[model samples]
Target: MDADVWTERVARDYDTSSTHMYAPEVLGPAVDFLERRAGQGPALEFAVGTGRVALPLSERGIRVAGIEKSEPMARELCGKPGGEDVPVTVGDMTTARVTGAFSLVYLVYNAITCLLTQDEQVACFGNAAQHLAPGGRFVIEVFVPDLQRLPPGETARPFHIGEQHVGFDTYDLVNQHLVSHHYTVEAGRGTTFLSPHRYVWPSELDLMAKLAGLDLIERWADWNEAPFTSASRSHISVWRKPPSRTGTL
Candidate 1:
């Protein structure tokens, strides 16, 4: 499918369904990690969808701007309360001018996978580096691919939910990418969403960061700073722009 068409379909249902889609509840912890390391400086959110973390983070008094590629998603964000205050540019993250240096630049909700290629993903890190002040950090939230641990016939795994609508995500792993089929069924309505993502190893992401002149500073299984272990399902990785350009890692 064309990227434009795929984006359009997501734009329409984003607020209604996608916003509430992710489970294991990581937003609070992700934001909290940023707050602790971000200092009192400004922030830049890459996708800024529906101002999910942006609005709440801004309400906490963090100055924030965003680079949002989808106009419809930006428009949806603008309609929310306090949404008018966030400064967002509707353009591609790879080359978009985010304006002003920020102490923190974050792309949450596994948005980095939206780039579809390693080159594009690496470019995004470069773009983030260009907009960061010295000592600023870029934080990324993503799920580690678990297919290698499962059997060949296994595709679906029961994911997060309390007790209500049980959910499962089925994946087709080919090459280094995963074609995800997410199905969550409620009492009456059932939703199935397709998400095709390029899965990256933690070491590969670190290399990408290094290429952009950033160094891996921290890695956590959760935002609460849980130790990164093989059993961890997701990761919040933080990279720092060196305070001084001594070029020493």
Candidate 2:
């Protein structure tokens, strides 16, 4: 996470600018999916911006903590209605140590892409695994890279072209690097937000989990449990630590 990029200005406007994601229709399903796997969590959210998902889980009586690198974003989250109850540590998700063995640890909304390197992402998986007890699960929600959709000579794809926001992604296929350009117009003033990410294939993520001693348990196209297919745009993946036993294998 880049604190320099996520300035106070960005954090201040985050909730208002992305109000659509706060809608019950959008957050309800995500919360439900996580709550089910929480199984008496103590869930930990990586990059828990503005407590978008954490507070809701807390509302449902699930203990939720968070690791956020951007202090402004974490401050914005901590000030929410029930935010104070959800303890947040302002630190890197890849290595931030928070107490408690979580039943579920999750990174949502492609936040893993922010790591911008294979090693950081792999370390993030390790950290999540470190925080989990035996039989615990880790979840990640991320988009499938749109390389297939790009025209032969094109390096960018426009995903949103609405009045409030115009957004697109530019790809560096050789390195699997991606930069999302978000142009927003509000009150006659326009602002541009450029977020860089390293896109990883689903298979790569599964291998990362395996390297961390986790097993792939389930995968879906969405929080609704839609089947993940070649045509899917995004995916929700689940991996579980092996059940505890008295003796080692």
Candidate 3:
């Protein structure tokens, strides 16, 4: 599904359903990583759902803006304190444009996979470059595709199993596609939601960045800057645009 469809459906319950992501242990390091990179400059987020990272980062004294496809999600963010001050452009992150340049352009929590096509993902990199000042950084947090969890001939792998929620990812190896299936139970009622995404490798992302005139600067296992190794489940990657140089016209 596209961002508009899936994100709108998930908006109402996103904060509650994704509570684990907002926990201090998980969120603190992420905010710190971005805060250090952003310094005193402005930062822009792509697919900034419900202001999960932006709000707190703003409270740290950095200017924050966002590009979100779902109006419902943006509305939810606007309802929060200080959310009214955030300038959000309602459009596809791949093509959305906001005024001025940003020192950091970030997409966290596997949001890049939501684009579903390689071309769209590359376009997203280009869009991020367009919004960034020279020498600015683009950061992404995403899970590494874990095909090892899939047994021989198995197409689906369960990633989460809990009393209230069960989640699995069904892979299409040929197309590099995956659909996350989530079943949530509450009050003895079950609801299922399927979100389509295209899994991308770190090398492929580096190429995308290079195509947009950026260079890979860092790759960590997590927001805490752990060394990225083969056993790591996810990564926080950063790329930077080259600083401008003065030249005689």
List model 1 lDDT by residue over 155-239, tens digit each.
7665545333344556656656666555545466666667667777788899999999999989999788899998888898999
Whole-structure CA lDDT of model 2: 0.91
lDDT (Cα) of model 1: 0.78
- Each model's lDDT comes to 0.78, 0.91, 0.90
User: Which digits, one per residue and each the tens of the lDDT, describe model 3 over residues 1-249?
Assistant: 275554556788777666667889999999999999997789999999899999999999999999998888898999999997787898999998999989999999999999989999999999999999988999999999989778999999887787777889999999999999988877887777788889999999999999999999999999999999999989999999888885211
| TM-score head-to-head 1 vs 2, winner | 2
Model 1 alpha-carbon drift over 4 Å, by segment: 1-9, 18-25, 158-172, 184-191, 245-249
Q: Please give each candidate's TM-score.
A: 0.86, 0.96, 0.94
Model 2: what TM-score? 0.96
Per-prediction RMSD in angstroms? 3.4, 2.1, 2.5
Q: How does model 3 fare in lDDT? A: 0.90
Model 3, runs deviating above 4 Å: 7-9, 246-249
What is the total number of backbone clashes in candidate 2?
0
lDDT tens string, model 2, 110-179?
Answer: 9999998899999999999999988899999999999899999999998778778888999998988989
